[model samples]
Target: MSNEFKDILYEVGENAVRITINRPEVFNAFRLQTVEELIVAFQRANEEKSVNTVVLAGAGDKAFCTGGDQKAHLSEDGLYGPRGTVGLPIEELQTAIRDLRKVSIAQVQGFAIGGGNVFATLCDLTIASEKAVFGQVGPKVGSADPGWGTALLARHVGEKKAREIWFRCKKYSAQEACDMGLVNKVVPHDKLAEEVEEWAADINQMSPSAISICKRSFNADSENIRGISFMGVQSVKHYYMSEESKEGVRAFNEKRKPDFKKYV
Candidate 1:
């Protein structure tokens, strides 16, 4: 499975399948190809009878994921590479994680920012290492996640903290995240894998069908999520394609502060 993916690492475990974003050079920031691969990997995990859980991580200690790859993002074509025309692949991937019957765990180590933070939030549980950091870099980078990034995040951390996260683009430590109810647990960096394995073992001992039903029940707020996310996604699509979006991207690439003071 590792040989098949160009942007990710897939390994089937005794009771779980571990999917790690492989692009560590960029702090594991994802592009269109990466999200598509993740959707397939999670779907495969959902189908396997022996697989009672799915574990998500990233390749390096630098970042679990930094969200969209700002270095080369072109917006419209990201959902399906350079050909397809949609920017909602991450949105689709979020629903996949939540809707799957098997439990999903985000084993975050570092830099789960912006959409990356959303991915971790949408999972049934998140276990972070002491080194992990969570926040949103979207507004600073010409983007935002209206999906799990805001609404669902508020479900975990409450409205005020969620707003602080997205609006300020500030970083939160692993302990800070756990304090806000954003993550289930925070382990020492060296013990992360063992802790996650223990959690997976606990999950594997549960009844699959019951867990499935529970996940569905938890996701009953889907209607409101879809409505809010639909508007957010559409708004961002236009924002991503706008001249302001290009200026932000250009400034990021240039390693300077985006002079947004002149925009409005």
Candidate 2:
């Protein structure tokens, strides 16, 4: 929430709170530090009583986010930040977006892959640019988002599609995402901000109290998203502590296929 944010951008507009993952060089993948910044940024938006909606985005017109920072994940602690036992504050960010009462929207441009896809999935709505790509890469990267990225995704796009998404790790185009119910709408890359702002404005015109009730109503039946946050992080944490887990991170950094068979 502080102006000193290095990994992301946070701005409070009259009607909306906009947060952008600012690391374009790595296709906007999140490090543990980046996830920590997101948690604080979402907290900033949640506390803004006047804000009617929150916009989640990525910088440089490429990749809204690509999930955990593989480079940083190479360390001993793997993908954990300073907070939480496992160090991934993703569950907190997801909770902040859901519990904020206001509409949480993902304004995705491109490469919303891995856990980044969960950033879009768990949102109340997703508006994407024509260039946007959505997918899961956890298995390929020696990771997985067993939280909302799995159960909630199944609810959105069905069990079979969700399985294919995670198991196959194939990226989907914006229109494909729309047809699969991953996004609400898609526009030209140049018009993404305009479209998202307009949607936020319209949502702002609605009664905040009413929206709050509606959001809670929608989530009241499903609490597992919050409950399972630790499972994914913990599983990854366990793998990270093992010598076998080194291959994926090493192969990723080296830009080659991970020889998991060697580990087996």
Tens-digit per-residue lDDT, 1-264, candidate 1: 567999999998876789999999999988888989888888888888886889999998889998878776753532324422245476678767877889999999898987789888888899999999998888897777777678888999999999998889999999999999999999999999999999998889899999988888888865488678867787777677776776677788799999776765
lDDT of 1 at 126: 98
- In candidate 2, residue 141 scores what lDDT? 69
Model 2 clashing-pair count: 1
Runs in model 2 with CA error above 4 Å?
77-82
- Tell how far residue 8 is off in model 1, in angstroms: 0.8
| Residue 159 Cα positional deviation in candidate 1, in Å, after optimal superposition | 0.2
TM-score of each: 0.94, 0.94
TM-score of model 1 vs. true structure? 0.94
Q: Report the C-alpha displacement of residue 33, candidate 1, in angstroms.
A: 1.0
Q: Judging by lDDT against the true structure, name the best candidate.
A: 2
The lDDT per prediction is: 0.83, 0.84
Question: Which segments of model 1 are wrong by more than 4 Å?
Answer: 74-88
